[model samples]
Target chain A: MPKPNNQDANSLLVLGGTSAVALAYARLRASEGKPIILVGRNSDKLKLNQADLAARTKKPVDIHVCDLSDTAILDKNWNAVTSMGHNISEVFLAYGLLGDQLKTQKDSQKFLASLNTNFVSAAMWAEKAFDHFAYKGSGQITVIGSVAGDRGRQSNYHYGTAKGALEIFCDGMAHRAARFKGAKINILLVKPGFIDTPMTDHLDKGGLLWASPEKIAKITLKAVFRGKRKIYAPWFWRFILLLIRMTPRFAFHKTGL
Target chain B: MKPVLSWGRINDKYCNVVRADYFADPNLLTIAESSDNGMLLAHGMGRSYGDSGLNKGGVIFQTTRQNHILDFDTQTGIIKARAGITLEEILRVSVPQGWFLPVTPGTKYVTLGGAVANDVHGKNHHKVGSLGAHIMRLSLTRSDRKTVICSPRTQKKLFNMTIGGLGLTGFINWVEFKLKPIESSYLETENIPYTSLDEFFSLSEESAKWPYTVAWIDCFAPKSKQGRGIFTRAKFSNYGALDIHRDDHIATWPFVTPALFLNRFSITAFNFLYRWRPGARMKGRSHYDSFFYPLDGINHWNRLYGKAGFFQHQSLIPLERSKEGIGDLLDIIKESKQGSFLAVLKLHGPEYSPGTMSFCRPGKGVSLALDFANKGQKTRQLLERLDACVLKHNGRTYPAKDGRMSAQTFQTAFPQWTKLEAMRDPKFSSSFWRRVSQTTS
Candidate 1:
């Protein structure tokens, strides 16, 4: 778990800022009177969320609408936000799409599109955050991974593959940042299991196993504060994932988790 | 459609839950008008203990996503926000900036809209009155699809009715309210144990000047130790020494404790251990969260009451008769040997709520909240007996925490409810309203 520091949460730059996890984090920081800039599509939700965050934090919150699918310069959005005089001290890369494996399996366009938004473009955005953190010699980044990425499942292998790749990237980034002696940046790989968010609202939900976005946000922020590199949210998921990992491949295929 | 229950986990109802993002959503008013059975009402955090926020066989217009704060004035301390935002969210931002809700109930999870609709009072009812006191202006859409902005200065009738109108007047769109200025997120506090009802009254009188005062009484205490508990007084700590951050651990109740274990013996033991606390540690500074919402530290603590679920019987009687009324009520609970772990008593001053249907009036009122494990009809009979005693003393019970108050009890307690009923949106109703109206109508 990451422990929150008295680190004057300078300014936050959140991409796909309207996602449940993203919005929940924004709400948490907003309540703490921290300044934030939300970047996402859907101008209405952005405006509404911006208003919600503004009222919550009593701090100025700016919204920049960008289809992550269209443009590749959200680092420019971060620059635009920072140029407005808000320093980007903490950056959360929280934008992604949960690709339907069936659709991706049917068409190359769908597979490429899913990979572009969930992994390719997201990785580019992470690189931008890394470069800025590397320059400052200090910063924190929280990249949301998933339990789906823990193993290849028939239901969502595309989404899992993209997230799995992001996990490896975080592992590599941790070492790279560590190797740079002056780099004070900390990167955390957050694997949240079965979060009850709007994106996953279509699925049937059960008791105790599901985590609300607010609960996940609190865990993620605490992890960021502790500067813990890898974590399974809700604490119990670590054991659940461990069990899933240890299962024999032949038995795992039959169980169909 | 999904099944939802109140915070008490009692009064479960299934409804087509629709999340409304903004007032502009066309489906907002349409859903209410189109409900095939019962009425449509907006539901926010679902923190109400009873069915006041529940609508069976209808649509629930969920305002959680509509929780956007529209504007804020730093210097004036006035904030404009959508009705769906919670006090917890507000406190998170405001406390750090030296601003706090003028009046907040026991929990911070309640949404702004629900707080106003319930007209909730706090321990400081002696000073600030109910949550509706600070609301400057708010817009509510009626069944006719007309949005009206009601304030004390304009639309006085609806303003008074809607303040504690139980969200029947319409779906509250947004609200603008003033926040009280505070120096820090900590409070200077003192706790003095009182052995009897007389001592509790004296403590309240001595601490009357304090902004906040409340008591934790042992409902199951023997006659010799009756009304015995701690009386706590608090004032805000100074700004310069303010921590301006929260660093506390929060735990959750993972599962329901079995019904058999939550019997009289278990409850009595829990009450004894709880009352024994604070006597050894008489005085100290405490965080505002611990001061206001102690139960929030443990998420879903209500599950301790068991799977059958529990409902709180919170009734307030007049100040002059509190000693007699509350004493008699506690005696009944002691004899029954079936009640709660948390029995709260607070002295309400002459501060009046602007809502015509507001529960708080000029009284030295003591609110006794007992959580009864649902033994089916047995629980209902227990609450009804308590209600009979409270009503005999010219007292009123809070509808927000009620699931079983008789129609006569509600009508007699809140006479103005009739006038408000006439003004309510035809398309908006709740299970609580329908239940209580059974005999009254």
Candidate 2:
């Protein structure tokens, strides 16, 4: 989403370049013949994505290295991307840590590290993009939250807490965008449920409810183009999450979702 | 964990499925070395009809996520890509650029690695041979955690063994291959109706001048016109738009049709109407997707065979004896009253694949592919009898489409299996290999 005057600004900036969902989304947009910029922690993995995108679309693809845990270099990395001379009209925030909930329950260090990666670092990066978009007076930022953030569960409460925090940040950003006069900036919250990505490789994904990253990515790009504030990927997840949120405390404990 | 079955859905292997990614920290080989799941195998798209991609009670590395096109040269028509990328994905990028796969299987869902592993052949086998013939290089990682970049010029023997190696040699990291240049995405095709086995053979010979030729035989035709079919020949049209196909209206088979739905009566009727359909005897222009992959229009078409699934038997017979061999095979099938909805017949040229264990012979041959709905013991018996006929004709059954060819038949037909076994990675094994080699471990 860019201002009516900046329609020529077409470059897409993807923060989690190595992520399957992010890469899929980039591919869908790459066909439009627009430049793409990727930022991630792993240089080798990012290089592969760069090669794939560039070779397939015959479009310019650039990558920047930025480890989310290393907060000191966040500003420097953001600056490097913004100064690359491309009109980056949109930002896709897709990086997050799905840490082991059982291990985090016992190890305080691991718990905090998961929080730092999923929330503290993710929110900081999203905020930087928000500020830039606001300054430009028109842009869209899509943050990938999880359906698990709808409510805290015993299985992954820590991970849920981090995503839940991100959801709130997105909500506040939406409010801020509306209040800023003459600005058309928008924030889209994407809550994907049971996505069959490498991140969830350990889970049994044989159920019909599980969706491919490509399907989720397709839905996400369409939502961003339509200026949607928030959407649950695959559409069914919205009703499922609503039911989970409405459950009574006693019944919820018995079910143990 | 969910059960992992090959396309046939006949062989169900209890595997600890592990998703492999290019960005994985330890990498695929290291992950295999550390796993205690006894043996390992890499499954790409699971498009192989049988157990060739399965590792029973072992660790199966699902490489679908490893898909990525690394490089493409529009001028030279050469492309390099990771093994996990599917043919459909590659075509989506390359077709509009006026390049096409030199040889492609009937379905574009097969992965690059699986194509090399099976050395799949296409209708153009008469002109370009198989996919292995066009491959320039491969990146293979053996069980010792050592990755080797092999080509026909360097490490030639490993390269040969790796092709059609059934993922037993090692994990295929990526592949680089040559592509055929095309002027358009459409083909000027001619369809001719012929009756009798002799007419089919004569039509095949006459159509040899054409770049691509195949026939669809009605196995259930009346006794007098037993081997009658529609012969088709095509060449890439010189002038047309190079438009990449879009899969907007692909219909998925909602669920497994009941096994009863594919019985003799239904299949026979379908085959009857299929051969005499309005467009069955016309010359026309067709998109590459329709000409190459008609079944792909319906996603999950395998479900049509029912919960038991179906088995594909593709036999390659020498040109000298193909007429008699194929006739005998079809006669046996007809006598068994098992109707094959899809009965394809194609001719292979003198060109052979570079693989030592390649199924297609160096000399000219005729291949017949038939699909049989799984009928439990009855179907198993029919397939074994077909294998016996193939052995008598000095032909071989394709491993990629075989579920139950006896060890004797396999070892006899492919005596070079020992060479591949010698170079096989110690940690990699597949259900097909164990069954055909009769090796417990």
Candidate 3:
């Protein structure tokens, strides 16, 4: 397969279009003349965001409805779309749900469902995207990881564990894809601290470095364009998390994270 | 290769925040040419009262790790070193050898790069301009990763950009500046008390003729005595006639105070006693370290602010708006019932660098610094109000000290913000800029 020229590679496929961070990323890319294809479960929200993005960019955007929680449905729709000439040069896998740990612990079904949505679904999408890019021989995949994955805390270890798996998985995928000749698949894993997003709207503000969605998206896009392997959103979180990880175990357990 | 580093966690009582980050030891490779693909922001002793040294997630070319003295020309008083070198380090080696940084901030722990970033003004700003004026040349790594040598005559844009660019234009790896030769570590210091704002200005104007002058204003003073404060002036002692000894035992404060200790009442009392203290006249041999970073005596002084860190709101108003601007600002603080004990006033001269967003300009700028207890939303609202006033007077807020000012105010304060944005590297960013500027629609 021949590499797509910049003009021919102007389409974006955002896996989690309903995400404000993902939407912001889409908006930024759209501003740079790339049309976006928003993929998510919420048809109404996706349509609303599509309209908002079109109004912002003054360009038409496409929308697709697919609930990633149902792996079968997601794969079916993904296969059908790829078959229909959707040559997406960029695949943003930003879908994830922060399931209530207490509820998940009480119900095994809930825990399994959360795990499938957060980790399993991400891996499936990554594998599919990698295969697609290998066939086309060029593309970028960006995954929104969490700083909680750096070190698990009592507060949200379940979510952290899921994110941790995704991070390691992406790291391995990046390493493996680099060996394939003529195939260019750059992976960006974003480890963000507390972000003022709908997913974290109920939680109390965390720290001085907690970033806004728009800020995270701007940094994320910048990193994607630069082909960064990994980035800590709101840069201070890098130092902050580094300190948290390096804290001596004897003192770490005593000092509340 | 993995980076070797040392780390320290200090909770500031003044700002009431905990700062835990890696500090590059004096022996580490502080600035590797390989890392120059991204820009580096030199962090001195982390005492700009704000974000000048913070590079967010990007690499902050830690200068403290490479504070070795490269060379010192004793005869002409020319000094060159890696930009990470601190005023305290220079004073440590030179005070005994009879030399000093041509300019020093209130704190000696400040890195040479920070002084240039803030273009720090001291008691003698009126006479010396700023630290940038004394800087002869700098070796910087631009965004393109080229190690370019810049001086006033060569690469003048990069030179000015590095000076006050807030570490945005590039990383300053090494700098060469003119140093003032000193005879002794002691200063001939005197404190003159002023009962009113007019008197403070008169004394500041009069004392400028001398080599050094700084005023400590009492914010709690009544309307009639609004600027009533203590004025301290100093000049290098004629050590040629006195016996001088170099001792490694630098005088420093040793303990951190409780956060609640720096409240309005405590600071007000401290200011009153400081202004009217009996030991107003003193002539003793003091190390350059003690003379500059008096606060350095107490480690983790910022911890005094408790768990909710504080914000230092420092602004520069045109000399014409000094009296009205400062007076109105103080009145607002008083009305808000917010207590500020630490307020220092100084007269600024002309700005030499053309850093697109340089905070200093031509005028007698008065900086009003206050520690607002990080009371969450309340504190943020207050800062927004203060930012409004700063904008009203055509003044700008320091990005280093600001964690909450909006992009609109930033645009207003820095009319050249769009131009700088155009120049920003897509790959480079910081938490400070990310939070305040990147979020704006």
Candidate 4:
């Protein structure tokens, strides 16, 4: 594995900065003196997360309020931040909603909202970040995916389908970024199994392979620095999901997973 | 049923119960089988010091309940039973019939499955090797949940991997291995004391000519008497000369002696008395139970270290580094003033099994076991210093006894960690692995 570079001394932009994973990533990186621009929807939540990052790194964290759902506002914030003297070295796209599966089945609005948050917003953010990295010819983009995307289950097929689309989008984006001159952008699709986070707290007990956020963070950092392709946060999830995916359809359906 | 905390002991910050369980039906077979998951392996007696018998929160098709003798071929001394059979139970049934477990640990409370998981070795490791070498065949449940019978000739990799794989590759349901036929339950033993380090090494080397040999050293001894201990060697007595004690199963010490009981003053007094009391014993006779597990008589003996628990730093330095490495470690321990009453030094013969990860190697191995008072930062610092000495001598620490070494030191000690990591199923993990790898979740 490559040692962490002094890129922390440079300026960075996080498209969904209020994300727990994003904030954690930025805080760990900021400790090395990196300046961070945190873009999110809620100012209060973003401020709280920003304070957490600042406390750990003791470095000033800049926050910009912009709803990712609003393309105009997101574009405005992106242009304004890039217009500043800060040269963005890395961009972390970490934003998604675990929309209620039952609610989505009954309400068209819930289904559309889940689809938009999970896929559309993610693609838009990646597109903008890819364009910036393509222009600079050097940057890293990491998009957090889910193990759910490996195969659809009866319980959360809708959510899985959305993440599946997002992962494929990242794959395409990585291919495009490779062609840009001086652009060293690589899309990291983090396929984490059940994570014990605020988003999934209300759900029933998770599978035996559930990983904690801290574990996910450590593994993610290692993968990013190592430049691993399609990294599984805990690494064991790859084999487990592979086994699950390879099982015969008749036997798989009977598993009651 | 609520689980009672009977015989609570701590090792390396993790608390374990020597004999604690919630279930009541001893004849029950609670197999949590799944079609997709592998066949359920049962863990009866939890004598596995490491993660061999444990997978945190995973299904353990507990076979403690099904511990019944299904059949016994007394003519050939071949016995078969449900997988939950324990060595203690087997000893009770078969010892009178002139048969004993081919290999055993310091304790007889371990189950058959546990014996396979750890592939435990005995004082006779030099002669017979580990328990895995004696097994004829084992019934395993593969990842695909198929009941597969494996031996050295069939499913060879699975057989080898499952023997010492710590139960990660698959679960072992039933096993049949050869048992050594003993002439009697009595042992003709000899205890020889050595005052100097050199004397101890030479004596151990000389005693290895016998069938079984082990030495118990006082780790707290001063440099003037470093490596001083009693070398005990024994073999089964002939039928006519044996005095069997069948009803001697009662354990006298059921609880830990007070915390202050094992302090420096007491330990020093105990060591002095032990070395001098048995001054000249050429030969003697004793029951096999007493001869093998002397400390087993003391229930909850780990409680002697108090509630904070203790760390067992056992290292095997190569024969080339024996003199200097052992001397340096002893000096460090003395200078640090760490009170360790029990330090065991043994001579390891050539590696016998195909286990690539076995801690045993061809060398004169010295295992120094210490009972740290678990005094927060001070204890950790001492352990780190000891770790440095271990690394300096190119020695490796036993994973079963490790409780305080850092992840870096662990990686260095076991360089095959990356390969092991590659084979690990993310869903299967242990508290030991998680702590060492810093995988919190």
Candidate 5:
């Protein structure tokens, strides 16, 4: 899908909106007093985010908790979100898991859980959102992919593989949307490098490279509104990823990356 | 990613900063259990002049995102707002409604929580007291994850402790304060010249009936002209029209001015021209902006002091001994040749504040707020000398403006320190508390 030009479209539907990046994006939109429908499974986090957004924004924020890993639940949530009447100018997809890499490598259940959350659930949301938004013909879908997916990191390869699959699924969605007339479905694949969030709490973070969720959200919002089809958050990540993608396999193995 | 500094642009520190959108639980992050300075301090607009607001290598809970004016009553002049709401915000909403804050500090860039935490006093402090005087209620969350609502009447002791508690008591969620009704946002102000400290005292005494009064001293003046400066007296003009001019802030000091640019020569030159500024003796009709927050015109004006940072020393001496105490203090300043251009002297009424450790006592306050480029040993020695003179006269310095005051100074000033220590949250502590309290043992 080509970049859509209509950024002033009234509403936003954010899945996994409780994530720090997603919450910051929602806040930017809410500060403009715009309507937002937040979807996630954790009611506690949703409630917390809801209180925060409500206090900051003039509009009444609506939160719906649906476990995205469950396909039936995703369908029900899709219907519920569409019915809320935001016109859902943009559907922000932020659901995924960075499950413990060592645990996942040893435990099949852990690996499956990560894969189901990072790939299968995203695919389900994309299919449901694309079908509905395509019929409507004017909306955007933003999925947060990661730099880890560019070339699997040894420490986080499981999560990376799932994200790699999700990226291909989104590419197919973008291609299929071209066949439908009047459907200006802009699909944005946002790839962010190391971000400081609750997910990265275990890592000792402090540096020029680790972008705060606020910084990533600002970059993501700028890209989405400008209708960029793809973006490496912080913009500099584009160069970092290019260098990584160009590394020859023999040399890359020698580097122990 | 860089270290955050306070308004004074001194004592910069790095911390795991978190945004408390609305109300994020303080305990969510696995912060160290009181390691060195492990306590999480709520940072608002970074307005404090010293380490009172800094958490060295600890967590800082940023409350700027939680700014929301939840409720306002026009007739009763009551407003309920989140702690993160700034005075500039309150003025934006309340000014045009013929209302204003009961008390305001020198700048409006500070948050309501910070103002309440410091219990800041304005020129009208003689009449209205500190910001805490107008606060009707507050919602505070404890380190143990319990939320409590307190006012002067309910949870009386806790309410008083949290007022000027410097954020050690809990996370202030929201505050309710009674806005003083104003005729208009314009003030009919008068500026007069005073030649001596005795003359200032007389002028301050005579102007007690005026709603607001404050005097700026020319610290650069020779001993022959010592205590000579301007006294600005004002009261809201009785126009009864709620129409106030609002202009978008367009110009700001984009970057920090180099330290060398603010030497004794430059500060003295500015003070000389400022004292004799055009219409210094005229009766002027001024907006609340110039009358209350003249420094707010320059964004990060504190940066003008350079990277070393400056200290703002505000000491209160009992009314009876004020002349001798302030005289000794000024003589010490003159002898040392370390003078601040922004020295202010005011008289606080005898109405005792209920905030146990609130700095505003019934006395005469002489504030020496100068930017000394933090030349470590010499600067510390100069401030210590000033502390000695203040202590000799039984004067006490304000904790909010304090950076390096010895524990002896704090203990002597507020003998009630033991009371505050008893109520201090075990999970909460600060760099200032540790530094000053350590001197005891």
Candidate 6:
């Protein structure tokens, strides 16, 4: 058990328990001796992660399996986890589907599923976490956005739009947290570049642009602790995305980036 | 996909690389089943000095992302982890808990899968044997879509074959190994400078009681000081705290050092200075990292040899012929003037590893490892001559460190190649295996 700051020991709640980035962040905070709660769709993956984190941290690791896309049951899912008497101090929303752009563009079912998981479902969960944290007036919520969210691209406009909306929601949540007088609530939005994760494994993941999940996780944790509102992971993506967004409409269409 | 080079960077082959996901790999079975042409090999860290981890014009399953601790028993010191987890990661968790790996190579960057595939050894080999001896069970996923759980008591043949199996048997999913209990992460060490082969042997005999023993000989030393070097030995200290070394200030070689930087003159000067250094004969407490993997402090230290890379030649000679065999080998290297940057010598006990293709012999012997810069034909010829010398002494070169061993030499050294080849997953193959087995895709 963690050395308690008050009556209860603070805990970290990861929305996407099996995500490489989320797990990396969890490991970084593991030395604090805080309990961790992992939520994901796959129970086997969750159990494996639970074992891994529990061993490394030597602390309690709880797991809950729920399809994040099922927005209808998010209330029940959130209640099932938060009601377990873990004084949740931080929540990391790090799950999404990078659906096939070409396939999803032609298929509405895939498009909605991607949109629902990335935005609607994710937004609903974020709201619940934000409300819970805001009610306590002392908590953190980190959402993993993407550089693609800065400017829409034809290749991944659906994902870009969903992440863009999520970022906007995070912006509002940060503002809301500030509105709570004397509250220490913090909201961090981390927009990462091309991370060399399994999600982007299909693409040619070479060159200086691609970053590892561990690197992003480190950057995200630093930003969370420092209470930064928004930042691009790897730092270089800020300029690259700036250039892409600055490109003229006609020229941008010609480049098809 | 990009080209995955070996640690030596000798074989410049562009491979179709596929990385496993963090906790789940839904396509792993599909990829293995489809790549039935024997061009697929599992790769982790790419730490092997040779092409055992490389497959040209083939798919390489990169398992680094699968790194995760599956379970750990603090009471029994038994730990089960994904094959992709590195030894450094294991130590970070285990060391503070008063446990350590049964056997670790010179570097902790190697993955559990790579360590098992190579059946790596440490200075403690004489006491605890190779890493294969400590492994309790392992889960191997083959190309046939079967996950076989093998241990010493069950699936024994496959279990033995998988150790030192060069990742050819199948993909190692997870490994359950016993950890040696330690009161502290520090070791009581001693460095004794010896002058000749005879004195070195005497020192080895004297230090038989030590758990870890190894020597660093200057290959460029004059004929009189031929086998002279510092013989270092160590055992776990009972007085220090169990704390893992935090490597926050490791120095990395920024780039490939110029080939001209490491010439005969520089190496000879370094060898002279290193031998006569102030602490050459010092005795004190040392951290396990400094005592076991001093080279690991310099990240990408291999780049010091230059862009063309270097070749690591490790050979084990029988005890009876060790003095003469080692003398002849040193003479050959000295005459060639192809001095090595790191030359290590150690005595091995008469302990056999469970791995069928393990490089160490069942009989007592002495193993010598040296690294020579890739001077093209000069280096190749020198290594071949060294191979001939080892073969004359009825010794075998380690496949894990070998980049170019003729099929004849390999077959002569390890006659059981046919057995391992027969059991090799038809869909799995490596450049080293192909070259040594004289097989084609």
Q: How many residue pairs clash in each candidate?
A: 11, 0, 21, 6, 0, 0
Q: Could you give the TM-score of chain B for each candidate, in order? A: 0.95, 0.97, 0.83, 0.83, 0.94, 0.97
Per-model lDDT: 0.82, 0.87, 0.68, 0.66, 0.78, 0.88
Global lDDT for candidate 6? 0.88
C-alpha TM-scores of all predictions: 0.86, 0.94, 0.56, 0.56, 0.77, 0.94
Model 1: per-residue Cα lDDT over B1-441, one tens digit each: 678888788889887776664425434456865566847988998988889999988888888766667887768889888888888777766666678888989988888999999988898888878878888999888867678899999998999899889988888888999998888788888888779989988988888889999888888788988888888898887744444335354888989989989887887788777767654246878888888998888888889889989979888888777889998888888877786778888888764668888878545577766677888887788788889999998899989998779998998888787888899888888988888776655
- Residue lDDT tens for model 3, B59-93: 54445544444566656777776666677656654
All candidates in order of DockQ, best leading: 6, 2, 1, 5, 3, 4
Residue B416 shift from truth in candidate 5, angstroms: 2.0
TM-score top scorer: 6
Model 5's CAPRI class is incorrect
lDDT of 4 by residue, B54-152 (tens): 433334444554444444554576665545667876776566557777878788777777677666677877666777777878876544346678788
Candidate 2: misplaced stretches above 4 Å? A1-9, A103-110, A179-183, B25-37, B439-441
lDDT of 6 by residue, A1-257 (tens): 33323226788999998888998888877755678999999999899888888997777788889998898898999898787668898999999988888998999999999999999999999899888887787898899998889998888899999999999999888888888886788889999998888788778767899888889998998898788989999999999999999998999999767
* Per-model RMSD to reference: 4.7, 3.3, 20.5, 26.7, 6.3, 2.8
DockQ of each: 0.46, 0.67, 0.01, 0.01, 0.10, 0.69
DockQ of candidate 1 is: 0.46
Give the CA lDDT, 0 to 100, for residue A63 in model 4. Answer: 78
Against the true structure, candidate 4 reaches a TM-score of 0.56
Residue by residue across B321-384, what tens digits does model 5's lDDT show?
7888877778877777666878888877754456877887544454444445565687788889
* CA lDDT, candidate 3, residue B103: 72
Candidate 4 structure quality by residue, lDDT tens digits, A1-257: 22223344566677777665676577557545677778888887676566545533434567778777665466776787676556677777778888878899899888988888888877888888888877777777888889888898888888899999988998888778666666588778898888766576565644666776656866887787887658877888889899989999999899767
Candidate 4: residue pairs that collide: A8-A34, A137-A182, A137-A183, A236-B426, B26-B65, B27-B65
Which 10-residue window in model 4 chain B sums to the lowest lDDT? Answer: B14-23
Candidate 2 residue-wise lDDT, B278-366, digit = tens:
88988999999999999888888888899999999999999999989989999999999998999999989976679888878545988
